[model samples]
Target: MLPAHRLPHLLSQAVDLQVSRCPYHFEPHPPSFSSQIRYSLLTDHLCPRSEFPSETVHILTAHSDEVWFLVFSHDGSRLASGAKDGEIILWDMKGESPKVQHKMRGQTDGIAHLAWSPDDSLLLSCGREDCPGAIVFNTQSGEVKCRVQNSAEDSLTCGAWSPDGQHFYVGGTRGQFLECALDGSVSSSWEGIRVNALAAHSSPRSVYAADTHCRIRRYNFQDMSYDNLIEEDHSIMSFTVSRSGRNALLNVANQGVHVWDLNDRCLVRRCHGVTQGHYTIHSCYGGLNDSFIASGSEDGNVYVWRSGKEKPALVLRGHSRTVNCVAWNPVYPTTLASASDDGTVRVWGKEKAALRQRQLAAASEPTGITGNGDVSESTSERRGELGGGGVGGLATSASSLASEQLDESLSAASLAEVGSDWQLAVDSLTSSMDSSVGVQPLSLPSLSSRPLPPPSDQLPADEEDEDQVTGSISTEV
Candidate 1:
């Protein structure tokens, strides 16, 4: 039932070409009607970091039960998470700290994995209910953007957006994967064994689907048929391609992480003993410089590793149960968020070195530098201090004195040039900092000037509107 506009493009492949049997294969499961265990969103009652050993750093909790899947925005400003209890929470991860900004509910049955549009304005979530499947709403505006009934079929397991975001591919319980347009129409599908995971090829709008029987097949978006792709000896729990689309990381159940070089179509490297538990690696994503790999395990840990390293860069330990999904921060490469069966979501980062690199890279961006030259002075002074030579004692003393004078001169110049805007900003910032530091300072933002969005008082009336609004046509996918 693809939209009229897209049918021509989608059906062209089936016209003259010999229809090939779907090469993707998977293990068979006896048909049963029982539902999977549902998890709830985490509650705020237990602190997020309590499950971990650290204390100074606080955790941001939003769900009251298990989080089935979580993904960060393309720019990393926000996060979208779906729970087994049919709750969808959107978190603002930017600013000095992170907080849950919105919670959406519409799907009666628990939601499965979710895919964000490339530009991050809209989200598409699919699940099963009365029949086999239903796709419903959990968007930013709370609008039910679109809903689809799958001719009464089981729920879809995983899905991925095409690079252009105009279309998406979904894998279903019936051992088939289908491609459809955003307008709610199935364009094409390959009927096969149970399709567990699907990923959009990095270079083309084409897609790759992995079945339960350890087979991976590629399909060209231009035509809806399978292309010969690589396969594994065991079922692939997860797979991620590098930024350059040259290499891939594949996680097979109980087989650790496998590195496949797509260029050569051969296995290049493998890390042993990564999959200790029976749990599958739900998600595999590339990290900073495309040198690192980030994975969430059913064993309840988020592990970060490099290409050649036997040991992991960081092992994030927090979730009480298995970690089902994870997403890397696009803007902050070292940061990753994980959702667990224990109903908690944890944001993990590599050690100090990684954090330091991330911070430096962040600060180096033109947009990162803000408000006058106040912060620049501090950075410049530190660089100078670090670069200073180990000269004779008297010369070192003279140089040190000269550097101190230069610092004072720069500081004065910055203050003078900042003018009124700088003063007001500095005062507001200092006041906030003082409060956080346990020292009362100056006044806060004027209540009249900083009007908050309609509070909980206005939420009830807006609830319907918020839950059903879709992004503008101009909105980023």
Candidate 2:
């Protein structure tokens, strides 16, 4: 016994309330037939989807020898890689496919390390014994703009350009750390225990040098004095500071990588299982927002571990020999590059259609039919029916209709019209299921359409005795 005006308003309120509460209590009742169909469609839309795993997108293989060091310019447009064959290759990464833009030959022995100037106009390279101590070259022209020679017999281990790009810090195998100008003139020299690695920090205006004696010393350019930052049990071969400069990743020789909190001056995390037996392998931070750490393994694979996770997230197999270095493109977060003794740099990313196929495959596992025997078909046939565009087409049409209806005013008349159209659309969909015409079984796109290369082409597991030499410039006085 409701008033005419109150009845319509009350009915609308009841409908909205029921619609809002339906999703919470919409569990399928096996005891009912219509309920099962509703449940299947609802679950298909509501179920959480899994993400696709990243895969290799490209492989760069221009270096004949093992690639040792890789550094991307600040702008992330160019990547300079130094190989053991005394060659530095500049790759232009701005294109669809990474292309080798220039190749600069280093000394006969090889290029040990490479550092780009802050302005990306110059590149500093260190070489092995018998090669020049340090060379500052024009990045655009690959011309040796300046050369620093401490001694004819001295070998350079690591080098870093100052924040201002006016000076250079070059470490030698003979425990000699020399600060030189852009013109290769030595400004100052610090005689210390064998310096293995050097890193420059801009905020604090300091340079960090790791020595063979298991200690890291921070040298302040302001005071021109050095203070010990960290002292561990194992000899530190090389280290990379985090982008924030609040943490440092130290490569402890024979041991795994260790993360040190620069702010608190304490050990944060230890990423182990990266086999480091006879040589020094580099580690880098990558993944979304540098939340993961990637490193080379002596077992001929690339290992990636989340920041807090103890176990590695993925052990990528590609390198036939030791993976000497791993670099993530700064611009493209998904793109990763790994250098190996196999003389190749492989790029890893995700494929789109493969992702969709995986999603469809996972969705097909849950039985969409009810126990009422309305559909007596095998799972494969059911999958084919779904893939043939029945459910997808229905969903698309329903969504389009809903959107078109929603575009109009949400008055009572409009709502009634929309409800009528929706009921008719559902009825039409159900009727179409009785006939096979225009029904394409739901199936993934043919794998042959965009087939991936064979596994052998992606990750070569055969280990040939390639002359693998430690490109680390370690000179013992």
Off by over 4 Å in 1: 1-58, 106-109, 128-131, 134-138, 202-205, 276-278, 350-477
The total number of steric clashes, by the backbone 3 Å criterion, in model 1 comes to: 26
Report the poorest 10 consecutive residues by lDDT, candidate 1: 468-477
Show the colliding residue pairs in model 2. 173-475, 384-441, 384-442, 386-442, 387-441, 387-442, 387-443, 388-440, 388-441, 388-442
Best by TM-score: 2
1-477: candidate 2 lDDT, tens digit per residue: 867668546544544433323211122223333233333221122211112124444456678888887877877898888889888988887644466777898756777788899999999998764554788889899899988886776657788878888888888657678888888998887765467888987734468888878888888665678787888898887888888888898888887889998778889878866899757788887654566687888888777766665455456664678888888776565667777787777665543322233234334434322231221122223224234334563443344334323223232333344454443443444345425333432322333244322222121112212211111111110
Q: Write the per-residue lDDT of candidate 1 for residues 48-68, one digit (tens) a residue.
A: 111111111113445766777
TM-score for each candidate, following the candidate numbering: 0.59, 0.65
Q: What TM-score does candidate 2 get on C-alpha atoms?
A: 0.65
Model 1 Cα RMSD, 1 decimal: 23.0
Per-residue lDDT of 69 in model 2: 78
Give lDDT per model, in order: 0.55, 0.63
